[model samples]
Structures are given as structure tokens and as C-alpha cells.
Target: MLDPSVAAVRRAVRVALSRVAEGGTALVALSGGADSLALAAATAFEARKRGIRVASVTVDHGLQTGSAAVAARAADQARALGIDDAEVVRVEVTGAGGPEAAARDARYAALRAAAAARGAAAVLLGHTLDDQAETVLLGLARGAGGTSLAGMPPSRDDGGVAWARPLLGVRRAVTHAACAAQGLEPWHDPHNAEDRFSRVRVRERVLPVLEAELGPGIAEALARTAEQLREDAEAFAEMIDETIEDIVEPAEAGIAVSVAALAANPVALRHRVIRYVVDSEFGVALTRAQTLEVARLVTDWSGQGPIDLPGCTAARRGALIVFTARA
Candidate 1:
């Protein structure tokens, strides 16, 4: 009999695998961690059942000693678990946005390259519910808007490959249980236990404390919040797309929005309109403070000078709020 945790993970992977074309490989990003190992196991089973090939890629960030060994072992485990095509790609992590963000960017690039080389139809990630909850908490802590708090999407298309996170509904503990149920030994990264990383602290300390004080299921609540926010963001996107076409006009090295149209809309839509205009024309996102300042050009109607934002500046020119490129 399959363990319940394993079965749950398998079910999720089956849905993800359904997106892959028949005769094409579905590449699993295996790190030998419990989440990824369980993912690889499930992909192997489910892909085979659907007459699809399963492959695995283990990324070595080269951060710690014996990292290559870890990567090699992960690939070996992939082969042992009925994944005949297993490979390891080593990446140099540039500490650009600190270490975590840089490593993730490099890892994903490496995985995309590997998947393309392997002719895989899509790449599978193992980010689970706990990860989503932590992401939302971090976004909220940073005072990010709805889209940031929306957390990770279940699937996204990058360049050409479709990236899917099938385990977004699965809990971290369940991945561990799934690996154990399948007699798979998982590698525990020491970085995960380190207190220095914000995510590690959230996982080890913040979330546990929250759960204890607020009762259990706080993680689930956070994940749900992210899902709901994502839905709201999607709707806002549709509205913005429909609305931007009418109220915006091309200006001198910039874009202009009708101040009358913006001020007449509801506050929520007004704010979104300002943001969407700046984002579309300038290729930059406005902070809430900046957005509010931009809105003042419409609502307050004071004769103010140009308000500088990231990569652009906003100014009130009669009935138009013009956003122009920063000199």
C-alpha cells in the first residue's frame, strides 16, 4: 500500500505530467532534498504510466565543501529511482541579490539549459506549500503589494520550457514522509538550518513560533492568502490591460494618462492605473509611496514639479499626467 503522503505527492505530479507531450521527457529538478527526491520518485512513476520519459537534473551551487559529491549522489539516486537519464550541472552563484536570489537565478538557468539539451517538454520544481507560505510572509514583511504576496505560481513558462511546481499543495513534512515511505535517503542541506538566511529563520523560528502562538494551520492560511491575492492580481491585470489602451497616449520620451479618467475611477482602480502606466512605459515598478505621489497629480491637482521614480519621472501637464524617462 502506498503511504498517504506519497500518494498525495504522486497525484500532484500526475497533474503536472499531464501538461507534458507524449514521447517527450519531463525533467525533474532534483536536489536530493526530501521535497525534490519525492518529486523525482513520483515523476518516475507517473511519467512511466503515461508513456513519457522522466529525467532528472541536480544543480550544484558549489557553495560548500563536497557540493559536487552531493550533486553526484543526487543524480545516482535519480537513476536508482528508475530515472535513466540523470545529470548534474554545476553553477557559480554570484551574490547579486544576496546569496539566495543569485543561486536561484543561476540554478534555474542551468536547469533550463539542461532541459533544452535533454529535449524535455517541461521542467518540474519541488517548491511546496511551506515555501509558498514563507514567500508570502517575506513579501508582507517587505511591505510589498498584492502581487508580491501572491507567492509562487503553480506553473510558469520561461523562454520556451514550461516550469511547473506540482508540489505547491503538498506540505514539507509530507515530502519527508514520502521519501521515507519509498526508502529514499534525502540530503539535508546545512544552509536550511543556518539562522543567517531569512528563509531559514522563517522556517526554523518564525513560522514555528507563529504556529505555536496562533495555533496550527497558520502555514495553510498563509498559502491560501497567497492564492487569493494571486486571483485578485490576475483580475487587476485584466482590468489594467483593458483600461490602459483608452486613457494613455504617447508623449515626449514618455507616456501620458488622462488625469480626468484616472481621478474619476475608484481609488483602487486609480492606484492600479497609475502603477500600470508607469510600469508599462518605464519598465519599472513604483513603490506605494511613489504611486501615491503620482496619484496626487490627479487628486490633489497642485502645481508640483516632476516627481522622480525609478528610471522615470512623473509630472502633471494640464489634463495629462506624463511619465517620462529620467534624464
Candidate 2:
């Protein structure tokens, strides 16, 4: 009999791989952790049945001691799982936004490069339902609004590379169980226990407390909330695309939106249009307050001076709200 945990993971991987072309390659991001290791093994099994080539990439951020050795062991595990081509890519983690953010940026860049080099149809990630719950909870705590609360999408395309997360519906414990069932030893990263990282705090402290006090299904409930919000976001995105074409036009430096058009929609759609326009034009996100201030130009037309944004400025000029790049 197939282990139920293994079956659950394999089923998820099989469904995610359906979009990949037969005989094309898929790359799994293997960190040697239970979640990623289980994903790698399942991908190897499922992709073989579908005539899809499978490989694994273990990113070494070199943050912890002996990180290279850990990456090498992960690669070896990938090979043992019948993944023929396993590569370890060492990345220089440097940038703003602290160590965790920097490491993540470097790791993603390496994964994208690996996928591009191999012309892989998809890159598989191991973020599970628990991760989704943690993300939503963090977003809520930060008051980051709907976009952050929407959590991670199951699939997205970045620079022509398809990134897929199949286990977003599976629990984290299931991955650990799957690894044990298959005699796979997952490397437990020490960073996971350290509460210095916000995610670690959420995982180690916040979630357990919520589960104990709020009952046993807090994580599942949060995951479901994320799924629903993501659905609404998709619908709004389509609406923004349609509405933006009719109301937005080129300005002197950035872009201009129709004031009357902005005023015509409900507050929800209006705020979305305001945010979508600025983001699409200037490549910067606006806060809810910033967005409201922008919307006020249409709602409370008081001939106010230009509102300064991160990379641009917004002001009303007759029928149009003009957004211009800051010099």
C-alpha cells in the first residue's frame, strides 16, 4: 500500500505538472528540508510517468556554517530519489531588507537562472498550506491590505519561467511524514527555531498559540482566507486591465488618469485603479493612505498641491489626474 502522506504529495505534484509539456523538463528547488525533499521525490516519480524530465537545484546562500556541505547532501538526496541531474548553486546574499530578504532574493535569482539555462518548463516550490497561513497572518499583523493577505499564488510566470507551488494545499506535517515514510532524512535548519526572523516567530510562537486558544484549525482557516482573497485579486486585476485602458493615458513624465472615470467607480474599484496605474507606470507600490490621498483629488477636488509619492507625484488638472515622475 502506498503511504498516504507520500500519496498526498505525489498527487499534488502530479496535478501541478499537468501544465508542463510532455518530454519537457521541470526543476525542483530542493533545500533538503522535509517539504522540499518530499516535493523533489514526488516530482521525480510523477514526472517520469508523464515522460517529463526532472532535475533539482539546491541553492547555497552560505549564511550558516557548512552550508555548502548541506547543499551537497541535498543534491545527493535528489540523485537518490532518481533525479539524474542535481546541481548546487552558491549565491552571494547581499542587498537591503535584512539577511532573510537578501538570501531569498539571491536564491530566487539563482533558481531563475538555472531554469533559463535548462529551458525548464516549470520550477517547483515546496511552500505548503502552513506557509500560506503564516504569510496571511503576517500580512494581517502588518496591516498590508488585500494584496499581502492574498498570500502566494499556486503558479506564476516570471521572466518566462513558470514557478509552481503544488503543496500549498498540503500541511507541513504531511511533508515531514512523507519523508519519514520513504526513509528520507530531512536537514532541519537551525534558523527555523530562532525567533529573530519574523517568519520563525510566526511559525514557532504565533501559530501554535492561535491553534491552542482558537482551536485546532487556525492554519487551515487562514489558508482558506488567502485562497479566497487571491481569487478576488484575480478578478480585480482583470477589471483593472479593462478599465485602465479606457481611463489612463501618457502624461508629461509618467501617466494621467481620468478624474471623472475614477469618480465613477465604487470606492473599491477606484482605489484599485489608483494603485494599479501608479504601480504599472512607475514600478512602485503605494500605501493605502497614499492611494486614498490620490483618490481625494477626484472625490474632494480642492485644487490641492501635488501629492508626493515614492517615485512620482499626483495632481489634478481639470478632467485628468496627472502622475509625473519626481525629478
Candidate 3:
């Protein structure tokens, strides 16, 4: 019988690559780790059957002492797996949102750029179910609300290139087992063992505790919650789009929404509409407090003066609530 881990990962790669334009190249963002290496191996094995070209790109975030060397070794593994055009790209990580967030942003941007340069239809990521659960948990810790809890999509389009996480349905242990079954040695990142990063702490301490106390399957449950939230969020997004068109209009420097229209809707929709308009117009994300204060102009009108926000100002101009860019 075929190994269950191998079968599971291969099926995931096949299904993920199926969405990409056939007869085109698919790039795997290999990090020399089990998750990405297993993904690369599966893609290499499946691409030929699908008539799709496969390659791998190892990103050197230049954080660790020997990151470049690790990336080179990963590229070598990709080449050994029948991918001839394996390449390593190095990036400088800034501490903009701390080390982890900065590194992720740089790595994904580099992957998308590589895809566009090569005309690759899709870039496959190595995020597993554990990653999704951790992400949802982090969002919850930050009080990031429902949208943040929705977690990562299976696939998304950014900068005209498609990005996919074929392994989100797969477990971290499964990827490691798949690599072992293939006689492949996977590089373990030392950061994963450290408690400095919140993610590492979650993986090591929090999740283990949750699994022990909750009797396992907590990660799967979190992943399932994220999936359901994503579906519901998509529906809410469509409703917001449909409602925004009729009630919102361009204002002096930003946008305006009908106060009467906003007040007429449920409180849930009203806050969403307010935040959506500001985000789209001025690129500012309003906190729940900020959004609620803005909503007050509609629900509790009493000749209140203009309210200051992150990148814009909200004021009641008769029947309309105007959001103007702050000078």
C-alpha cells in the first residue's frame, strides 16, 4: 500500500496546480524545510503527468548566519527532484513589523516577483493546517476581529500573480513523514525551536497545552473555524459591495456615505460600510473604537463636530457623512 502521507501531499499538489493554466510553469517556494521540500517533491512528481513545467525558488531571508548556504542546498534538492531551473533569491529583512512579519512580507513579495518574471501561472506556498491554526489564534490574541480570524485563503491573486497554499489541508507531521519516506533530508529551521517568536511559542507551548488539555484536534478545530469564517466573510464582502454602490459617493477629498442609509442598516453592516469606505479611500484601517465612533454620527446625530481619524476626518454634512483626507 502507498504511504498515506505521500498520497495526501501528492493529491494536494495536483489539486493546487490544476487551478493554474496548464502547459505553464509552476514555481514552488521551497524553504529547505519539510513542508516546502515535500511540496517541491510532489510538484516535481505530478507536473509531468499534468503536462506542466515545474521549478523551485528558495528564498534566503538573510536572517540566520548560514541562510544563503541553506538556500543553495534547497535549490540543489530541487534540481535533484527533476527541476532544472532551481534558483535561490536573497532578501534583506527589515524590522518593520518585527522579524517574523518582515521576513514573511519580503519572502512572499520575492516569490510573486519571481513568478511574474518567469511568467509562471502560480506560486505554491508551504503553509500547513498548523500554520493556519496558529494564524487564527494570533489574530484572536491581537483582538483583530472576525476578518482576521478568517485566516488565509487556499489561493489568492496578488500583483497579477496567483499564490496558493496546497498544503493547508495537510499536517506538519505529514510533510515530515513524506520527506522521510522519499529518503529526503529536510532542514529544520532553528527559529522554530526558539521562544522569541510568538509563532514558535504557540507551536511549542500554547498548542501543546491546548492539545493536552483539550484532548487533541484543537488545531484542526481552529482550522475548521477559519474556513467557515472565510466563507461567511466572503458573503459579507459581497453584501458590502452591493450596498456600498447605492449609498456611497465621492466627497471633497475622500468619500461620503448617506447617513440615513447607514443608520437604516443593521449595526454590523453600518460599521463595516464605514470602515470599508475609509480603507478603500484613504488606506487607513479603523480600529473597532474608531469605526464605532464614526458610526455614532449616523445613529446619534446631535450637531457633533468633525471627528479625526487615522488618515481622514469624518463630519456630518446634513444627510451625508463626509470622509475627507486630512491635510
TM-score for each predicted model, relative to the true structure: 0.95, 0.99, 0.97
User: Between prediction 1 and prediction 2, which has the larger lDDT?
Assistant: 2
Report residue 297 deviation for candidate 2 (angstroms).
0.7
What's the CA error at residue 244 for candidate 2, in Å? 0.8
What are the per-residue Cα lDDT tens digits for candidate 3 across 1-327? Answer: 778999999999989888777699999999999999999999999998888988788989998998889999999999999999898999888868787889989987888788888899889999999999999999999998788998999998877667899999999999999999999999999988989888899988999999999898999999999999998888888999888999988887888999889989988878888889999999999999999899989988798999999999999999999999999
- The clash tally of candidate 3 reads 0
lDDT score, residue 14, model 1? 92
What are the per-residue Cα lDDT tens digits for candidate 2 across 1-327? 999999999999999999999989999999999999999999999998999999899999999999999999999999998998999999999999899899999999999999999999999999999999999989999899787899999999987778999999999999999999999999999999888889999998999999999899999999999989999999988988877889989989889999899999989999998988889889989999999999999999887999999999999999999999999
Q: 203, model 1: CA deviation in Å?
A: 1.1
Residue pair clashes in candidate 1: none
Most accurate candidate by lDDT: 2
Whichever of 1 and 3 has more lDDT, that candidate is 1
Alpha-carbon lDDT of model 3: 0.91
Task: Give the Å error, residue 131, model 3.
Answer: 0.4
Off by over 4 Å in 1: none
Candidate 1 lDDT by residue in tens digits, 89-186: 98999867788899999998899888888888889999999999999999999999998999999988877778999999999999999998989999
Taking the candidates one at a time, how many backbone clashes does each contain?
0, 0, 0
User: Residue 218: error of model 1 in Å?
Assistant: 0.8
Q: What is candidate 1's TM-score against the reference?
A: 0.95
